[model samples]
Target chain A: MSETPASSVPRRVRDASEAEILDRLLPRYAAARGAEVGPGDDAAVMIQLGDRYVVTTDMMIHGPDFRWAWHTPFELGWKAAVTNLADVYAMGARPTGLVIALAATADTELTALEELADGLTAACARLAPGCAVVGGDLSVSDTFTIAITAFGDLEDRAPVLRSGARVGDVIALAGDAGRAAHGLDLLFAEGVDAAGVPNADATAALRAREPELVAAQLTPNPPIPAGIDAALAGATSMMDVSDGLALDASRIARASSVALDLDTAAFAAEPNLERALRGGEDHALLATFPATSTLPEPFRAIGVVRAGAGVLRDGAPLTGKLGWDPYTAWDGQLG
Target chain B: MSETPASSVPRRVRDASEAEILDRLLPRYAAARGAEVGPGDDAAVMIQLGDRYVVTTDMMIHGPDFRWAWHTPFELGWKAAVTNLADVYAMGARPTGLVIALAATADTELTALEELADGLTAACARLAPGCAVVGGDLSVSDTFTIAITAFGDLEDRAPVLRSGARVGDVIALAGDAGRAAHGLDLLFAEGVDAAGVPNADATAALRAREPELVAAQLTPNPPIPAGIDAALAGATSMMDVSDGLALDASRIARASSVALDLDTAAFAAEPNLERALRGGEDHALLATFPATSTLPEPFRAIGVVRAGAGVLRDGAPLTGKLGWDPYTAWDGQLG
Candidate 1:
């Protein structure tokens, strides 16, 4: 995945003991701000802020979840962290700690794993200051898997939930709508072969041509701070727009028993309107606020909440597929 | 691994959508006791008991960490939950919540996953009362993996660390030491063919003959409650004896800058003294208490701390392999 030639990778995971690999990887992570006992213990201890805390987990696997040839280990780590952090932020909480469980093949390059640790550290420092990896586990497996569980401090604020949306509220989204999905389309169309095989040379060329789109797909920097802002701004309801705008909005609508009526004109700046509606993995924050509340920074109004069910585009029922489904969408293809 | 007939499992995971599978599985988990916002939200919010919490993570992969041919889905889930819970218990905290990330092949049976959820719930209810699965993610992968992150409430008590052991302290152990490892050996010797293929009939026969050993290996019930008892009784140091007595004792010795002088005479009651000293995965609690302190129920004195470095057996340095290492020990054989 990395451009660092395979020849330069000095050792594989199998060549070293688990302790040796951990000695190299663990130092790259910064200690959590609230940590009392960090990485060396059987469990990490952290000081809590309020009487409540938020927790979420997600997993990224090789083959079905990703194509190893199309992503650097650093990007994989960053994306994994971003996705989980987005869930915690959706609850109107500030990210504080992360614990990773990684399973990889014996032949995996040790340097790649180190780079992954670096990316995790960098993302925590940049997106959520004071948050860091608190603990982790390593194991050997045929299919590479990275599972991260992120914790957040509520800061004494009540968590915002998808079921809190009220009728006649303003619908807003923070961060790009379809950029990551559009990047996926570009990668498959321009960088992959007819048989769905990834060509590294073609991918590099595409990266050069569309750095923003490619970066969006690879290392997404979700609007983490906007979650706390929306909560403080009196958000009625909130969620992470993970499985496409239409699908995720529908979830909110179903949960709140309301309808989200969207205006495509608000998305006129996007390169593809359809992708904005149907594409997935953008990791944006979708929130609804009272009509009297002022919209927070980075959030732009795209629609309004009505007394109905499901999502509507320009006042019509959304047609075609809603979003990605791992079970039905994965076609046994891998890079 | 279950005795249920294969034909009884009527549906595969691929036959249903991810939402459909979630709809069936999510309800099986009980809400955490402190949950303000449980599953169905982007993240779960739990009210903290004190100003601090302990967190730990562990992963079980299909091949190196577990054998599909040797364990039922229920056992796998129980083992996964127990393993993580033991880590929290070792820190002298009460487990409050768990978030699981499960990845399995599309061809996996839907019933198997449901049984896994049931196992997780049963373990939480029985071992760590009030603790439950608060959130989880499901994905498709070629190799089945279960990654669980457990959170524990400190109850405003200080966490017990491995580095607190002092010279002249009493080294104590609660629960069986070598039974799980012995079960693994029995399975490999009697229930598997020379080519490393599992024979279900042989496995069933062996399970019936040695139920306790097999149960120890499959669904271990670690001394979870004793962790709090040890802490309340003024334990100097504690950890889960997961990687053999000699090896884990050596870790405490190195961390505390003292030697653990174990008496094999104390292990004479065990069926296999050698396995008790060198085997792994029993999930026993190992703690050190002051010489003047009374030992807690279920905890028995096994040795004493001395002014030296590393583990000593009857005044001699321990010899032979310490314990299991996934990287160096796996022989590329799967049943």
Candidate 2:
């Protein structure tokens, strides 16, 4: 959850027509490569590359996923787009285009919605350079909701699946670890109540001191090119660590019928090592490569793939809380 | 603007964990072609044909788009899938796969969600022979929301865009235009109160008398094959009449820089001409072809594309409210 306050603009969605909202937000999505027909059509037409395409969808709801008090509409949009892009990259594909489904209360400020659109396009331009927000649907609901679909082109490389990890492979990671998880701590440390209400005074003070950590949680800039790079380097199995290390690593382990043994000593030099191991939304790629292969830039070996099951920390069985599980993690109706 | 009450089922979403829900719903999706990684992975991998792909997304919210009392979970899921498939066909593409993003309050019944999943797979099987729900995300929200992405293969045929219609082309339509609109009226006349609440007593009476009309509104089965047929028979321009005939026709008119004049006389033999012209969710193909072209099955001449602006009803300017525009059309935050 976040504490990003609602924008104080006067004209809300209910005040304008749907056509007006579309007119205002549509311009934010500029044309990108391979787009034969762009937004404003019944559907978008884009050129697919090679013989395959990679696709994924993700959602960030207001209460369970974020709080307006902690994120600007722009940041929320950016984070939503970037995190979803991380998934495409996780599959060893180059992020291509997107279609967004945005729902909010009728009283939501138009400026807020525009800021959100700006954030989406801004992330596409910065993180996935060749991608664009090609299509979207807008509607009114009781709370803010965003469902984004991201597509990717694998070039000529075959997709790397989580089930392909072979025993004797070295497990590596690309991008920051545990940053978003710690970022969430900083958010809650601002004196957030169990009900998720943010104390304005604490939030403002934290904003002054822990801006980077807060930004990390609000607008994660995961390494988008690493997945394709890993695939090019012959990655056998890979996935984005949105669900933290041990839990996600176990997923790969079970899928590939291999166990992942991580060395805690590998993180002795890092601060918040626990967060790195337990934080979800790290949005980094966890991949397995051939044992003797040289790892790519910004990627380092963190574990080894072996014939077994589940995940191990320093060769010991991993247990306890490791990440967010929207269902069990939060009790009852969050919003 | 609906009057249906909430479901009375004892089990709500908050009662189960996400894993449990996934366990119950995943089995309904089964499998499909081109999906190499499928669901349960970080992202799904699928093969793309030809050089380009057609993509579109649609959203359905609880109150504005549907009501629990008015339909079943299966129908809701099926409607969402079928309507989106209509969009792919509108672009003259055969749908190959889909990814759905569904959100509902934690208190929502798990059974409802499962029924929805069943509906999605059922629609894919019936309307799109080889299509599958390849990927999806589940989240908690204040209201039920479903956002679906449907991708299609053009089979190397150039996409027939709305901008391709030319002056002197004849406008033709496949599938029923106003079936859904009249269906809505049937729902309302079943003694829906001002709060949009359905009177259960009246609902049962109307259901027994007008099952087909109610089904049209709740589960529109558009002629999906008509889109490909129109494209194969040399359609110049095309679109699905989702937001009523007049409004959508005007959209093509604006895109193609041509005026469309519909001959009401063409509907003299029809029973629901007004509903056909003014109802949204008709989920039918509206296209333009060369005047001398031989049209295929289910398509009939309705109007002509000519030099001018806007849509005409029997040579007269279209007036009155024509279709849905959620924001301005309804008041307050629904659902």
Cα lDDT computed for each candidate against the true fold? 0.89, 0.84
lDDT (tens digit, per residue) of candidate 2 on B1-335:
12233544336667666767788888999587767768888788788778888889999988778877787899999999988999999999989889999987766777888899999999988888888899999888777889999998888988889988999999998888787888888887673655667655666677789888888888999887788888898999999988888989988999999899998887887687777788888788999999999988789899888789889887788888867776666534333
TM-score, predicted candidate 1 vs. hidden true structure: 0.97
The list of candidate 2 runs beyond 4 A from truth reads: A1-10, A191-196, A199-201, A331-335, B1-11, B191-195, B199-201, B331-335
Best by TM-score: 1
What clash count does candidate 2 reach? Answer: 16
Q: What is the TM-score of chain B in candidate 2?
A: 0.92
| TM-score per candidate | 0.97, 0.95
Question: Worst ten-residue run, lDDT, model 1 chain B?
Answer: B1-10
Q: DockQ of all candidates, in order?
A: 0.88, 0.78
- What C-alpha lDDT does candidate 1 achieve relative to the native structure? 0.89
Candidate 1, position A219, lDDT: 91
In model 1, the Cα lDDT at residue A239 comes to 95
Please give, for residues A133-161, the per-residue lDDT of candidate 1 as tens digits.
99999988888899999999999999999
